[model samples]
Target: MRADTVEPPARPSAQAPATSVPVPARIAAHGASAADRVAVTGPDTTLTYGELDDRADRLAAALQAAGARPGSCVAVLLPRSARYVLAAAAVMKAGAAYLPLDPATPADRVEYILGDAATAVVLTDHERAGTLPAGPWTVIDLDEPRSLVPAPQTPADPHIGPDSLAYVIYTSGSTGRPKGVEITHANLANLVDWHNAAFEVSSDDRASQVAGLGFDAAVWEIWPPLAAGAALHVADEGTHRSPQLLQDWLVEKQITIGFAPTLLAEQLIAAQWPAHTALRTLLTGAERLNRRPLAGLPFTLVNNYGPTECTVVATSGEVGPEGNHPGPPSIGRPIPGTLALLLDEAQRPVGEGEPGELVLAGPHVGRGYRHDPERTAERFVTVRTGDGETVRAYRTGDRVRRLDDGRLIFLGRLDDQVKVRGYRIEPAEITSWLTQAPGVGAGTVTVLGDESGEGERELVAYVVASGDQPPAAAEVRAFLAAQLPDYMVPAHVVTLDALPMTPNGKLDRAALPRPAVVAEPAASPAGESTDDVKVWLGELIAELLNLGQVGEDDNIFLLGGHSMLAMQVVSRVRQRYGVKMTLRQLFRGPTVSAIAAEVAQQQQEASA
Candidate 1:
């Protein structure tokens, strides 16, 4: 079913009831009282609540001194560091909306966001300060001596309303450009309050910050802790790759609360939990939470669901061995102070057991998009129920069924939205880039190849060669490099003579061919010189391809070595030989001996 094209139920009400809150005081109150508590922990540094608040105050004062007006957009480009959190808080404190520009984002994309938002000021560290596109805006570097100057104390502004824009998050737009979703301070405050009350976050709780600063998940990673006087431990980029290191850090830091998507949680589960960790709450969201990942984790496992436009989260459910039931756990019930309804195409409430689009209504709803009024009107609409009451509800493009017990069961997305690395992706956007390459024709992409217990889905693309010319997979990848980000690009591209069609004549994605397997080479029968290297490559490829007798000349891609498998191969290669091999190297040299030789050469050069 086409999700975005599916017409939603008509609005029940002509107008939505106004639900807004005061913004500045909420943050100030939390900051003032918990200033001395630990707020953020990074690789080798820790910022107490007091330190964070002070830094934010200084930054806000600087912005205000530079003539930044309330509601103005303040763009931030930085890594996942403590400064990013402080800068966001500072933007809110200054009564300006924060726009997080992810460092990993392409320069052109970042320029588009800054221009669209008409950013008044930008706060970045020295490393990324010069990377921003040329613009007429004040730039403040946190590392500079001038940035350390403390401005006069600006009292908390009580005038900032809940409906005021707190931040703007840009989603991967299917139409080739990113669209910004404007979230208000009131919306964030409501979400934080809901989480604090529901999860019972206390001053003693320590939450882990794993998601990137640019995503909505970061809100959950940052605010709940500050609001509840709890601590937040920021995981470094390297920690995300090493499950063992992450597990050790989680235990050593005594993190009581953290959230990861089911994929990462499954990885942790597979690696086995460390003996010393004391995790009280393990919240999973941004994707479906399967049962296997939560099977033996000694903590409360919460499966959460919500869109970026609806604050951090709107619904959550607890999962455990005793309560384990069925395929995927229910999304549970609406969060406190939130209303969830299942409605059919007619905007009528669906009866129990009937499938419908899930609609969310509450104060946690964001302030709509930044500059796209038409797009905003299309997604966010007011719906009236049978009771003749009006509420502003976000039409979540999710297909769901109301369970007999009132819980909502996730069916699937009603649109092209797919989760990759816990970030929502629109396949159309990725396909647009793929089709731009020379010799490329109609391209249809779908996420297939999910591990038995892992919730992560691997993206695979099926393309019909244009006319008589078909572009090589490598060339297509090179073409995509300039047009799209790494995550959006398909890991595997399969050329098809013609796509299979359903009875209705729609493309039948299930009939696509899986990549052919190629045998990796066995060790030379002549000598012991290459024994250990051959043995290692054989074991790695065997585990990846689920086969033995891998020939030396066997191509990795032909053996079904996609990006994820390539990463696994690289990690194992690095661990065994103490040498690094890039993803490109693996693609170029798909054989054991070739890759081993390349690594050996690099090691020799380093030693020289």
Candidate 2:
């Protein structure tokens, strides 16, 4: 530990104000008070406060008639459009908490979540409603002609209280099943108050909603701006992953407040920000903040840390442009109305400078997992603080050390869970699926190697065959693709006769061997292309993948392409062709031929 690693004694206090109002009430206040303000802005449409409020009111009446009651779970599973915002507000207007499901999620995962959540009604557009897996619930297409008109009569307030259920977000669980963290209106109010007060959001501020609805950060992205009477701009599809495109978008929109995952923030920090950039504040969390003390940025760079169980943000710190810290940067101190306690295995506070499991308790804490009493009891505990006051808190499985000065430094995880691209993944989730696959008796999955070496985190799996011959690594990957999302598919799959175990019968994680490269089926050659652009782009993509051959139509993501790889491809395109391609363009046109065609069109337009 360095000498300057002192705790921040003056960290923000967690004394939240007493509030009897729900989050919707706050929004309703804004709607009445700031009716002309831009409430929600997206690429295709925009909603003013009055417009959003009226639509929500009309839709709420229809929802109540359709049997949506208070405390019911109404799922909003639409694309990031104006309809998405309307559906969310309308669900709350109907006196029910809304569950947001990202349309990009795999069908299997969506099915599991809808069933587990006991969703009362799923609100989606006409195009997407048919795509949803048939479930034993009502699927209302919000785009239907009848839904365009709100029901007659102004619906009375459902009397949503501070203690009522607000939202239920699903997160990775240690036991292979996904757990839903039930956040109450009071928890949201605590976060909204702290954020609005801390950031000083006003009508001049334009906040960006870059996070997908499925992410807990979306909770923060949506509420704070609306509550502060600020404009909330929703980024279009394929904008979240690519840092360069997202940075350009932020600058173009003149957004004052924005939130991104840690990786993208690091990229933006490294980028050459425009001198007159309107972006004022960049808030990042969801993963560890590796690149600290950003250099030469005309914005307030805030590193926030929290889990789904504790609203969105528990601790947040703003680093200066100097980016110079005495030691390894920490996740910062507790946010307002939140407490961070470091305890040993016995739940006793550790000595100064010692590391222990982190426990978070405060007004921002949620109401624990939905319908999971056993898990709720285990993780959410009532404990006595050092001041001899008993309070309810959530036991975060993260390890951290409290500095002598008062701040807390994050160490690492105390469990097998890992975060990849800001998504919390349980190794057990992968191992459980591996064991169920045919010809597999038992299996183990590990996040292999250091994250830096692999460009990104790689989920590696080792499975012992139940038959005479072990299955091929490629074979297992294909099996997993149908059931798992693209991200959950292992980067490398290895076959083993048996796994090494210790004398005590516990599997020794250190003994697991490094995974070898898995052989994939050979791709057919790209036909003799006289077009130089096509040939150049194909070779560039092949070089990036280290593959022997890449067809013009080969999908980059399907062929093991990641965000880092995608960035490299874009960089090469800019270097060779002078065509500025967006990440969304790459996502839409993932093949070498498709990219070359896009580049060719740009050249044609330039010449014309």
- Using lDDT as the measure, the top candidate is 2
lDDT of 1 at 570: 64
TM-score of 1: 0.70
Off by over 4 Å in 1: 1-35, 147-158, 294-296, 416-568, 571-608
How does each model score on TM-score?
0.70, 0.75
lDDT of 1 by residue, 1-608 (tens): 32322221211111222334333454456568866677788874788877877777777888887656677899888777787888888888888888887776778988888888888998888888877788978888877967646566653452567667788888767688988888887787777766776677888898898775666787787877777777888887645433445677788889998876544553354345755668877776765443434356666667778888898788776654423354445667677667888888888998767888988898778878788899888889999966889988899888787655556667776765777776678665566456556566555667765534267677777664554344577787778777777887777876543344322122445555555422123333322245566667877787778886687777777776644566557645654555656544665577888876776676678779
How close to the true structure is residue 162 of candidate 1, measured as C-alpha lDDT?
Answer: 64
Model 2 lDDT per residue over 392-471, tens place? 99999998887665667676678756877666786756665675566665567788656554557788887755554557
Global lDDT for candidate 1? 0.69
- Tell me the spans in candidate 2 whose CA falls farther than 4 Å from its real position: 1-3, 6-20, 147-150, 321-323, 416-594, 597-608
Which has the greatest TM-score?
2
